[model samples]
Target: MNENQSSRRRFVVSVGTAALVGLAGCGAQQGESAQTSTQQTTTQTETTTPTEAADTPTTTQKSSKSDADGPVVEMKTDNEGSYFDPKGLVVEPGTTVRFVNISGTHSTAAYHPDNDDGPLRIPDGADPWKSKLFTDTDAVFEHTFETEGVYDFYCAPHEMLGMVGRIVVGEPQGGPATESPTDIPPAAQESLPAVETIVSEQRVSGP
Candidate 1:
């Protein structure tokens, strides 16, 4: 073959080889980009699934006491009488009773059958169990009934005029309204101070 023709053929072959190499490099780059995009999409999906599941609303359990089971009573002190509005309250063993004192100088005192006989007055280590005398303004108290029994309490200064209240804590086997009698301490029953029931109006605010 002639020298110039051989040189031209060699140049053409070199150009073709260079073009093939460039195309292979472009294919490899595209494959790597596709892999990276797929991985990012998978990661985002995994992160969002758990967050959406956590945001789902959960159901709350209801209390055992039905609306018809017991009456929602109030303890109020008014001009006519300074005493517990309902005079009595009934609750189940696991029920929680809230005492909102709206008026008068009063306290929910629950001493043992013999407060003077020893230090076994009221339950041991009860948290805010005893409500202090309401001399200044209105206050609120709450207690949970865990044991199945009756709890008798009297006002510190108004027990003489029969300012007493009872908490029947537990389910009655026979039927509703059945309660066991609570024993009041002798010292508490002896002489309760006589104080005028201070009547005051309380403003309760809520939505």
Candidate 2:
């Protein structure tokens, strides 16, 4: 072969090798950039996950007796025995009464014909309320008094034991509860608070 042709062939080979190396370097740089972009995307997704969890709603808590719409009554036990803590209460019409069981099994039942065929002790047109036996501590029941009259309630299982109470709504008015009770047990008759006393005192505690 001739000298010029050999030299020209060498130069061509050298230029081709340099071009391939440059292309390889560019490919490596592009691959690294793509990998970095993917890593940044994964990091962004991880950072937003905790914020989503923080935005989730939480459970609501139960309201306390002080937050009730009206007065609160507690069915509790003491050295004397099981009974309503405040034997009598006086409230305004449309007031709600919250009955909370502090201890032992008890219930807040109105003296009504629907409950054990008892005579109506609440106002004639007033709605009767009866609660199931509350055995769980802190169990609660609520009733709203729309009528302006006396209300006499008893604990069914403990009525004979004198677990009875009274409530006078607004001014004292005529009702079966205001009259002398004839159908109740002797203990309940003695334990029930007087409407006059409830009105004057606003609250009467048990004996």
Candidate 3:
């Protein structure tokens, strides 16, 4: 072939090769994008599955407390944080309060000036009592509320760590109002909000 024809043939071949390579590169990029989308969809599905499963049981338990197992007064004593579960509770007079030892070496000690470690906040004529540390079934403490007033108590060792609680028997009657955070030990600062919530929102009229 002549030089002119030869040059034209080479140019056409080069152009054809470049077009083929560009098409291949585009196919590869599209494949990668499709793969990435599938992986992201799978990750989202996995994440949502556990959350949906977890929420159902939690919602059901909170919404439905069976009458058979429910009680007039109950409280939890946790070992891990060395604090009571509810922080405060309100119950009727003559009701029995069952303290479940949920965690720790805990005790229920009435707040009294005679204890010399804390203030006196029990109801008028209410007897003061203290339970021994968790050493068996003694881990469980039960107190009957016979007076209509506020009773404050603490865990022996964890009181300094803010491990304290209160019980309001029947409706509040001439009891000290909601206590300020400044009145409690410095360690109990975190518990002040819970104290306020129970005192204001949980009080029940004695039946």
Q: What is the C-alpha local distance difference test score of candidate 1?
A: 0.37
- In the predicted model 1, the residue pairs found to clash are none
Please give the RMSD to the true structure for each candidate, in Å. 31.4, 30.9, 27.9
Candidate lDDT scores, in order, read 0.37, 0.70, 0.49
Best by lDDT: 2
The candidate, 1 or 3, that scores higher on lDDT is 3
**Cα lDDT for residue 44, model 3?**
7
Ranking by lDDT: 2, 3, 1
- The residue-by-residue lDDT of candidate 2 on 1-207, one tens digit each, is 112211011111122222222234434354432222222111000000111232221211234666344577889877889899788999888776878888888888889876677888988756666777777577666676767889999998789999999999897788788889877899999998878778888999874
How much is 175 displaced in model 2, in angstroms? Answer: 1.3
lDDT per residue, candidate 1, 27-70, as tens digits? Answer: 53544322222221110000001112322212212232233533
How accurate locally is residue 16 in candidate 1, as Cα lDDT from 0 to 100? 20
Q: Residues 56-152, candidate 3, lDDT per residue (tens digit)?
A: 2110111122234333222333344566655677777765565555545666666754444456567554555455554322234555566677777
Query: Which candidate, 2 or 3, has the higher lDDT?
Result: 2
Model 1 stretches astray by more than 4 angstroms? 1-75, 113-128, 172-207
C-alpha RMSD in Å of predicted model 2 compared with the true structure:
30.9
